[model samples]
Target: MKVSVVKIGGNIIDNVEALDTFIQQFAQLEGLKVLVHGGGKSASALMKQMGLEPQMINGRRITDAETLKVVTMMYGGLINKNIVAGLQAQHCNALGLTGADANIIEAHKRPVKEIDFGFVGDVDKVNIAPLKAFFEAGLVPVFCALTHDNQGQLLNTNADTIASQIAVGLSEAYEVSLKYCFEKTGVLMDINDESSLIAHIHQGNYSGLKADGVIADGMIPKLDNAFDAIGEGVAEVQIGKAENLLQKEFIGTSITA
Candidate 1:
């Protein structure tokens, strides 16, 4: 059985009708075992609605103690349940879970050094047993990136990091293909130019491309996670657009070992 981990970004979640369309397309994939990791567009919106200003540090949420609660509720509770419900409506048995469930993902609370972000976690380990049980049971494991430390204190982890961790974990447990679908078609040579999708990228060229300023902003972290997964034995990392998701031929940049 081939398992595939598909991470749908926050940008995609923001569009309601578009998301529904994607879900319909995703459900149609034949014999595909999938895992989904989503982020906080709705969560951030809810935080703002409640008069809490969301902060970001180096593209990650500055999850202070108070903000951590907001994030947990938003991502793990609202968004997680909503997506699961949507998938379930399509008759897809998608199970929503947090990283803390069955210690499926374990993290250590990263101490504040230069950054004063509270309760942010860096994933140190991921246990794929529970995930395997769900997948083997014919359920799509939809994980919301929230994890905990030894003390069982909940910590906020980066969504991309969570996606990469799941990809690695799934790869280790089964032979799987990993796909990172976002707003962009792929890593472009020119940030302003949409047509410049890099067809193929290698480990050595990744550095040079970033140095040359081809990889910028959000794409850098996504690419880093993709490369990290590839290094950890994931067969391939394809970054692409949401609408083109159904296509057999990947139009985005392919990161290969």
Candidate 2:
């Protein structure tokens, strides 16, 4: 059995036309598949309207008490439903979910070290039974970036981490191909030059790429997560533009174990 666990971030979701196009492309992907999506500016935009200033540190949102409510509504309710509805329009049956639903994903609050990232979660487990059941029912599971403590409290989790963990968990039953699709056309030697895209990366060369400063900042964690997933039995991992999602030829940076 083969499954493609594709994750699309804020860049695609924020754009109306881009999301619709991606949904169409997602419907075209072969075999069993799952979609993990991140909330864009919608949550923060709604927060601002509600007189709450969004806070962030090192590219991660600071999900406080009030912020958590907005995220739960925006991520789980609005954004998730829209994507599910779009998939339905494409004749693809997508079931929208949160980690809280079906107890699909379990996570714990991040212990405070220096920064107190209130209500943020680090994933602890991915339950594959429901996922497998969903797949058998011909349903594509669409997940939002919200997890729970199994104690009724919802926590804001990173979407990339959620995707990686889910792929690793699903690897037990399927030959998994995990994809981290975003705005860029893969890992670039130069963020400005698309031609500088690095088409391949593996454990052997990853450290060197970081030493050369080709991979840094936010991209570093994403690559680390990809490598972690690959090491944990995921057959393949790729990072690239959402535009190239359905292409038979993967025109993106392939990460290997």
Candidate 3:
């Protein structure tokens, strides 16, 4: 069987029209599929409203206890259920899930290095049996960025990493294609110019691109995970705009090992 694991981020979750369009397109996709989504700016805004300041280091959240609570409600509760409901409305059998549910993903609390990202988790294992069962039963699984330590504690995880890890885990049973949908069409040569999209990237040229500063910031980590997934046997990985979800041919930067 073939499967596509699609991950979406940015302000899409905050915009009703955009999210609805994306979900509609997603529902039209053929074959077994899964959706993994990131939390939007609303969580930070809610944290501020509750007197808790959101902190970040290099685009990764510093998930303290209070912030964890806010993200849990935002990612797992609001965003996950909303997407599932939207898919269901479109006649797709979508089931919302957190890593804690059915022990889909097990993680460990991030160790204290120079900075302490409290309540953050690094993925330790993924149980593929339940996910495969969902696929066999004709159910689409939608994932949130929250995972558990299997010790009764929920940990905040990165949605991008979760998506890649799921792709790697399911590669054993399926020909997997991982798509990351964001605001941009793809990784660009110039940050300010959308037309400067780099259509393809291979491991050989990645270092040169990074040296020239073409790939930096959050994109670097995202691509690193992409290449890792490719190395681990994911058939294809693409990063493009949300509209690509509706297209018959993929339009984005394709990653190669």
lDDT of 2 at 54: 94
lDDT per residue (tens digit) for residues 87-205 in model 2: 99999999999998899999999999989999999999999999999999999999999999999999999998999999999999999999999888999999999889899899899
C-alpha TM-score for every candidate: 0.89, 0.95, 0.93
Among all candidates shown, the one with the greatest TM-score: 2
Question: How far in Å is the alpha carbon of 129 misplaced in model 3?
Answer: 0.5
Candidate 3 residue 71 Cα shift, in angstroms, is: 1.3
- 89-205: candidate 3 lDDT, tens digit per residue: 999999999999989999999999999999999999989899999988999999999999999999999899999999999999999989999888898998888889998898899
User: For residues 154-212, what per-residue lDDT tens digits would candidate 1 score against the true structure?
Assistant: 98887777878877887876766777787877888876788988988888798898898
Evaluation by lDDT, superior candidate among 1 and 2: 2
Model 1 worst lDDT run, 10 consecutive residues: 31-40
User: Where is model 2 more than 4 Å wrong at Cα?
Assistant: 57-59
Model 1 local distance difference test score: 0.79
Best by lDDT: 2
Q: How high is the lDDT of residue 193 in model 3?
A: 89
Residue 13 lDDT in model 3? 85
**What number of backbone clashes does candidate 3 have, counting pairs of residues 3 or more apart or in separate chains?**
0
